[model samples]
Target chain A: MMKYYYDLMSQPSRACYIFLKKNKIPFTPCPLRITKGEHRSEEYTKINPFQLVPAIEHNGFNLTESVAILRYLCREFPHVGEEWYPSDSKIQARIDEYMEWQHLNTRMQLAMYFQTKFIIPKMTGTEPDMKTVERSQDRMETILDQFEEIWLDNRPYVAGDKITVADIVAICELEQPSMAGYDVTEGRPKLAEYMKRVKKHLQPEYDEAFEQVYRVRGRFWGGENAPHSKL
Target chain B: MMKYYYDLMSQPSRACYIFLKKNKIPFTPCPLRITKGEHRSEEYTKINPFQLVPAIEHNGFNLTESVAILRYLCREFPHVGEEWYPSDSKIQARIDEYMEWQHLNTRMQLAMYFQTKFIIPKMTGTEPDMKTVERSQDRMETILDQFEEIWLDNRPYVAGDKITVADIVAICELEQPSMAGYDVTEGRPKLAEYMKRVKKHLQPEYDEAFEQVYRVRGRFWGGENAPHSKL
Candidate 1:
């Protein structure tokens, strides 16, 4: 049996988790308490030298990096539908385009948001630099604008009408800033509606997995839910 | 016939160019002169709204980003061998692992090197800041150390004994700092040897494509050859 090593709070981990559940790929969920620095332990290091969450081990093979893992899952479970990753040359290329672009754009922008809202404050015991945070927010907005004007552009989802791995990868990262209370959908009505549609398309099992993870963090729909957890 | 829009000096463009030549994928080369701002022009904007180079148009379908183009070529020209992108799930996963990790580690670090050596001097209208340049160099060293300690180890290439798309993508970016006279491989003999092996594995036609571009810049092998043409 394959094993999934993840921390539910992690954006990438959630994407992988949702993907696995959506496909019904059975695997042992080995949850890592990232807040406790378990990811840095020698045990985890033996699995992934990079010490990042969202890794997997299967049949004596270990792999790290969310995109890589997702690609592997798609290959292993082709029945997830060609829409998850189109076999057509042109559509697949579009999927690759989003995957490549998002690393520097969506992924980096979300990391910036996380560092400002979470990591920096945790490390220094001080509020994040507002100037830097605002800059990151602005950059993220620009990317979203591009996404709407180019990639989405009235389409049902990224890549095409049917959902694909590109949407799964992107929506998870886009939701990160929202979790930090940034509310990226503020000025972007099209993106807000798009998000609603995506959530609707996601399998119930996958949606439940996301809800289960978020409920533990005491957040609903990625924002303040009145009473915050003391833990 | 497909048309390729690229600027040879750009890292992603170089990767696409190498892949095309290596696999004998014929296409019309439409050079976008980045230094002259050709890529930002309205003509190029219509082709790729992001205005980035390495965009391609084949059979009326337009595509941007090198990774997308590489994968497209892999599908269109499957004769390039499964080794470039193995059919085996585990091997392909390993290739994907390096591709994702290198984005931040290798690509970002090299960008820092380019910024310190090229962009800073132009912006300040004086000699570059040695402190900033040294900092970038240190970061590159750290990244290279990880490349050796984790990714490379005793393997002949990044993905394994066979040179895959991962190695091609990585080496093109790694070669950028070398073009600026920073021989990153100087201290790491193993990396230097591996680079030599990769260069040898690249088809002569593809090697010539790079040779033609780098020779004009007079920075083919770093050091004395790396004289700034504009200077």
Candidate 2:
């Protein structure tokens, strides 16, 4: 039996969760709450020395990093839909290009913006640094523009017409800024439409994973249950 | 004909160059001098929208990002040795894991340190900022520790006993800081031995690609012929 360890709030964790759920890959869900430092426990360290979320164990083979896990699953289980990873070398290369590029670009910038705006502030009990926040926002803006002009470029999805794990990983990372009350899709129609398509394609799983994220957002950003909520 | 665009100065570019030469993969080399701003030329944008070094064009297909390019080459040329990428799903996953983890941790920190200590100072005609340089060095130290403790914990190679692309990519990234006069392998015996093995395995091509890099290092850092050299 495969065992997956993750927390929904972490972007890569959310990505893995959504991928596993959508693909219906059977595995034990081992959810770790990063907010409480559960990921740093000595026991979990044995599973993933990095102590990062979205790790898995199958037949005693442990793995970390979402990209590796996704690729491993696709290869290990041939039943994983071809549309998600695809078998064609060229098309798969396009998807691989996005996946590799996103680590330093899309994922890094958005996560930085979100962390500077919300997580850091909350953890430190201090206001966010305006200069650092603005710089990250600028970077995030540039990355979003690239997504629109370079990756999307009027295509229905990131790699091509069909949604791949690259799209899944991207959308999860993009969603991080929302918790900080930043709407990344506000000025970019291409990105906005692409996000909608990705969301619709993932269906209940998308909404399911994001529900926990948005609830945390609601409590922190005063969306609905601000007064009574305690995350 | 497959066209590979790269600059030996860039780590990923050197990795791709070495891989191609070592594997005997036929490619038309399109070397671009990043220092000359050749990569950012309008003509190059058609090949890679990001105007980045280490891209490839093959069969009317364009791909950027080193990891993608390497994987594509492995798949496209089935004759390429399996040890580089490994057809076995588990070993491949291990290679993929290191490849993915290095982007943000190993590559980012080492590149940040190199840029802060050497590249930025050269471009601006100013001394390196000690504070930022120290911070990046600290981060680089942590990443190196992880490399030794987590990845290379007794394994002859990064993924396993056999040399893989992951080791190639890692060694190239690790070499960047040397230009800034940082000896990353100084305190780590395992890393030093691992580096030696990777170099020996790749042989003359490793020495070939690095000759240009070492030349650049010597020119700036006062090696032989420093007075007359202009990079």
Candidate 3:
């Protein structure tokens, strides 16, 4: 049995969890309360020195890094093949390119925006800096333009027709911003349609996983619901 | 021949160049003068949207992101074999884990250090902030301690006894700070020995590739030599 440590609200952890469930892989879920700083504990550090969520421990082997864990899952489980991770070298390479590029591009832009604008400000009880938030939004806008022009260009997915792990990795980040009421695909028809397709592919599972994501939605929307640390 | 666009002084470019040469894979080196702003040209952006050096074009398929390019070449070439990228699933996963982890930890700390200390300050005509540089160094020190204690714990190579692409990627980044005269392995005997082994394995090929690396070494050491934009 493999021990998976993750939080439902964390994007990468959600991605890993969704992938495991989608593939029907048998594993024990070891949820970590990241907002509570449980991940920083010595017990969790032994599992992952970096103390980030979404680490895996199988027997004696321990692994961290979401992409690597997803890659490992795809290779380790026989059920997950072409559709989950295309066997074609060119397609795999395209997926690889997006995964690498996203770390600095989509992941940073979205995560930083949420952190600076929402998470940090809320946690610290400080006012959110609109200037900094706008800068983060501005950077995301540039990458979104590239995403439409280059990545999702007329294809059904980032790589090609079939949905690969790249789409899973990307959508997770792209949707994270929506938690703060910034629906990215709102203005662009092409991107809006693409988002629809992504949601359709992962549907019930996606909705189930991101339920906690939207729990934070009311925080920025100025509703009665107060944002929990996790929210 | 597959066209590999690179600048020798760039660490990622050097790693890709050396890997191609070592594997006896045929590739035409298409050098891009990054310091001259050639990479940002409209013509180059058509090939790589991010306007960065170390891109590749295989026939009509254009690719960016050095790690992805390396992964593609390893898959595309037969002569490279499992030793370059292990055949065992678990071993390959470990390498994948390292490659992914390095981007945020090892790569970020080192790159931020150089950018904040040398490149940005030089371009802006301002004194480098020792405070920020020390912060970057502090972060690197923590990771270096982890590198010795965790990754390189008595192992001959990063993953195990055999050298994988991860070593090439790491060694290239590890050597970059030397130009600015930060010998990371100075007091750490284990890491210093590990670096020696890495250099020895790569041998004459490593020395030849890093020729321009040492050429720029004089720049930060306060010698008479002027630092080129490429440096």
Candidate 4:
């Protein structure tokens, strides 16, 4: 059996979690509480030297990196959906292009914004520097513009009309800022609609995976009364 | 014929260039001088709306992003070597892990350092902020440590015993800071040896592809007498 390690708070972990649930792949769930430093334990180091979550242990093979884990699972499991990761070389390359581009763009920008505004402050029990938060927000806006203009222009999904793993990973990143009470889809109808479509397509898995994020926000910003009460 | 568009100055572009050459994939070279703003031109946007290089146009299928281009080329062309991207599922996943990990870690850190210390200063004809350069260098050092400890520990290559596309991409990124006269291999015998092995194995192709980078470094730092005179 495959052992999947993750934390719901992590954007990529949720992506992997949704992928697993949607694919119906059987795995042993090893949820690590990142805030409690479960990932930093010496034992986890043997599994992933990097000490990051969203790792997998299949049989005896160990693999880290969420995107790699997703790819590996698709290849290893016969039942995994092709619509998410098509075997067609060109379509797969298109998906690969978005995945590669997002690492330093969508993933980095939204993550920085979320951490600067929410996670870091909550963890340290201190106020975040306003200047740094503004800078992160500014950088994130540029990335969002690019995401809208370049990736999502006149397209229903990031890679193409059909939903792929790119959409899953992208939505996961885009939602991180929302946990900080930031409205990322504000003023961007294309993105707003895209998110709705993605959520609708992924259905129960999307809502189920993001429930923890919503709960976290509710706790941080006062239950059910926060600006982004629902994602 | 496949149309390859790139600017050798960009790290990923050089990675793709080396892969194509080493794999003996035939393509028409459409070199874009990024410094001259060729990549940003309206004409090039049609080829890659993101306006970045290391793109490809094969059978009217246009694609961007260097990593994706390399993967596509490997799959599209049978003459491409298997050792660089093995057919073994586990080995490919291992390579995938590094490629995914490098984006925010190795690629971002080194590129930031290089840009802060060398490229931006040269482009603006202004002295770089020492504090920013130092911060970038500090971040890069941490990534270098991870690269040595996690990836290269007790192994000759990044993925395993044989050289892979990950090694090519890794060396390209690790060499960027050197252009600014920083010895990244200092105090790290493992990384130094790993780089040497990668360069030796890829040889001629590695040196050939990096010639432009060496020229850029030499021009910026002054002839062969300048520090890091040759990569």
Best candidate per lDDT, number? 2
What's the ranking of the predictions by TM-score, best on top? 2, 4, 3, 1
For candidate 2, give the lDDT: 0.89
Best by DockQ: 2
RMSD of each: 3.9, 3.7, 3.8, 2.0
Give DockQ for candidates 1 onward, in order.
Answer: 0.78, 0.91, 0.73, 0.88
Model 4: residues >4 Å from true position, as ranges?
A: A221-231, B219-231
lDDT of 1 by residue, A6-120 (tens): 9877878988888888888999999998889999999999999989988999888899999888888888878874758878888888888888888888888777876786567
* Shift of residue B166 alpha carbon in model 3, Å: 0.3
In model 4, pairs of residues that clash are: none
Cα lDDT tens digits, model 2, B2-108, are 99999999999999999999989999999999999999999899999999989998988999999999999899887775859879989999999999999999999
Clashing pairs in 2: none
Native-referenced DockQ of model 4? 0.88
Q: What CAPRI class is candidate 4?
A: high
**What are the models' TM-scores?**
0.91, 0.95, 0.93, 0.95
**Candidate 1: docking tier:** medium
Q: Per-residue lDDT of B85-111 in model 1, one digit per residue for the tens? A: 877777788888988888788988987
Off by over 4 Å in 3: A222-231, B222-231
Question: Native contacts retained by model 4, as a fraction?
Answer: 0.93
User: Whose DockQ is higher: candidate 1's or candidate 2's?
Assistant: 2
Q: Model 4: per-residue lDDT, tens digit, B1-231?
A: 999999888899999998888877889999999989999999889999888888999999999988888888888885674867888889999999999999999999999999999888988999999999999989999999999998998889999998889999899998887778777787888888888888888889988888887776677666645543433
Interface RMSD of candidate number 1: 1.2
Task: List residue ranges in candidate 2 displaced over 4 A.
Answer: A222-231, B222-231
Q: What local distance difference test score does each model get?
A: 0.79, 0.89, 0.82, 0.87
